[model samples]
Target chain A: MPKGVPERGSIPDDGLTTRQRRQQPVLAIHTGTGKGKSTAAFGMAMRAWNQGFDIGVFQFVKSAKWRVGEETALRALGDAHLASGIGGPVEWHKMGEGWSWIRKHGDDADHAEAAREGWAEIARRLASERHRFYLLDEFTYPLKWGWIEVSEVVEALRARPGNQHVVITGRDAPPELIAAADLVTEMTKIKHPMDAGRKGQRGIEW
Target chain B: MPKGVPERGSIPDDGLTTRQRRQQPVLAIHTGTGKGKSTAAFGMAMRAWNQGFDIGVFQFVKSAKWRVGEETALRALGDAHLASGIGGPVEWHKMGEGWSWIRKHGDDADHAEAAREGWAEIARRLASERHRFYLLDEFTYPLKWGWIEVSEVVEALRARPGNQHVVITGRDAPPELIAAADLVTEMTKIKHPMDAGRKGQRGIEW
Candidate 1:
């Protein structure tokens, strides 16, 4: 192994050294009509945080049902890093607020503008390499709802600066984004307790 | 809704009250060949931890190449909980030690015995409600290899005590476990950068 980089047993002749291959950016997405898509992306963020990578979590959802616990834990982790200088900094940004599954009140026009602004800010960050790991949680919804262009988002990710890794999580991801991704995983639902009248518990759901 | 529990719009008339339904335990599995199975389970563990649930992570594997970072972050979270009285306690146990992907060691018989013992221990804990959230990481291997009985594991999970939520992660899960699970998500791979000669990166992979 050159410079302690695992050769991965086989490598295509892409004219890039193993080190270069190791340093390449990762563009991935978690998509499907199932749960754990965003959870897995958050899980990757935890690993990235452990490795001292600057983390940026952008939530682009039409509604917020049960993600409070996740935010609290990640924020605590971020504070721990800031206090002890163990891990890198973490920044969490929500594109839209007050959109609820049970009670919806936010105006669509305002949310659309906010979503556009969020996408623009993410695009700027990608260009400047602001964060090593960018987690765009529930991002496909805006694209699905026609509030953001999937092509533009893909182009920005494809041209991201440095070794930044981007992971997007949502359902019904556009084919263009899927085709452009280096890795994509669809969380297919086989069964759910909600089908059996089991209500969401506070700890498990959030 | 009754007592602020979300009714979920549709609930089958299973004779259980909304409160009882809210108290029902969840049995879930994250399976398939794609990535994010373990990551999603870890993500759920973080959520469970945030909600003040005692977490127990049991790792059953034939090889351990990475995963050092995950253990570190979770342990730090555990320590913070004890120090600050926030979140919950965490117990992480690895069944097999010195088993490596690069250099495989340890006798098969020993590992099988250890896995059996580990399963037995989990069964005991589930019966006793030792932990509020049980994470059986990569536990399908032992069941797949017949070192542990899938049916017995399913029975234990189905008959688990209290409000414990159990999530198992691995590839090629047994059909019995799948049938017994309330939630199952198969991570289907759409694309991978490794196919294009991309080696694993430290901050992302670990």
Candidate 2:
């Protein structure tokens, strides 16, 4: 009704009241060839964390060795939550080499297996309502690379019970997942610092 | 050279080495019709805060009446930083009606003046290196509304000294601003809950 607000019913008929809609879980996907997909998801994670949502972070591509700043801050918040009982649980898992199973048997097949295992774990968590908010960082690659099937992932996500929110971030997300998601954002690159021969810097990239 | 990696020299010859590039200030613009532009900037601010960078957040469009989750978390971090000397200073300012000055003198001309004043304060901070990281949230709106001049903002940003990092977020960013920025990302909307008649939700929109 407002000048800037989108026209009424421009938001398609989802056949739910505002209250009913608020109760429904959200599946948000951030995909594009820009820099902030994961970062934006992490920001949402921060908001969810502050609201006392149990948060799970599953990193698919970032090396465990790479110390991301948001991870550290959020992990600290998690620790504080545990100590003070102010917030909910926070769990961070790296599906790359850092995963114990993959670490035990390192190889290409193991990497693919590890991705499957990671998906399985997430599905388990989703079924059990393990976390209210899940950040699947750089997850689209698994689907794109065929390490994980998009259809299966979509099925699991759709079947996820309760009000669990999931955010998947990466470039070139599979179309099925995009179709399945309730919210999808594509971070298109207009220009990049690397275009000027600049590398990622601390506190900016991480 | 690699499949995913940009080709050698694809990053233009800025004549800046890794160290030099790292030391150079960053002007990042996040603009698009999609969500997460401000959220991504806040994520970077969190990273900057964790890295002991003095952080300043200037809100241009968001109502001061609305309390954002990032502001709360960051202000808390700022307090901890002050008490424990672990991180750096964090200052949050609202240049909207919530501002005492603007509230005291409410008018269209005053609103325009307030925008100018906000820019002037930022310019002053830039000159003095008041903060290492600045999040100019919803900043592009003022420029778009002609409350602030594009050339002036670009000039101020370009003339900024030191390694101070600034992230400006808003939709429909002026072409001049994009040209001046070293990094720019347009958050294109693929799908949104609002498209399905859902309003902003807690821990997601805020």
How large is the C-alpha RMSD of every model relative to the true structure? Answer: 5.2, 3.3
Q: Pairing residues by index, what is the TM-score of model 2?
A: 0.90
> How close to the true structure is residue B189 of candidate 2, measured as C-alpha lDDT?
85
Q: Tell me the TM-score of each prediction against the true structure.
A: 0.90, 0.90
Tens digit of lDDT per residue, candidate 2, span B90-175?
A: 88988764443334645434677787888888899899989999999888988999989999989989988888999999889999
**Poorly placed runs, candidate 2 (over 4 Å):** A1-15, A65-67, A83-87, A100-109, B1-15, B65-67, B97-109
- Please tell me which predicted candidate would have the highest lDDT against the true structure: 1
The digit string of per-residue lDDT tens for model 1 on A44-116 reads: 8889889889999888865455666777778778888988887777887765563222155456567877788
> Compared with the true structure, what per-residue lDDT tens digits does model 2 show for residues A14-130?
676667766778999999888789888888887887778899999886375333678777776676677666555688888765554345645535677778888998899899999
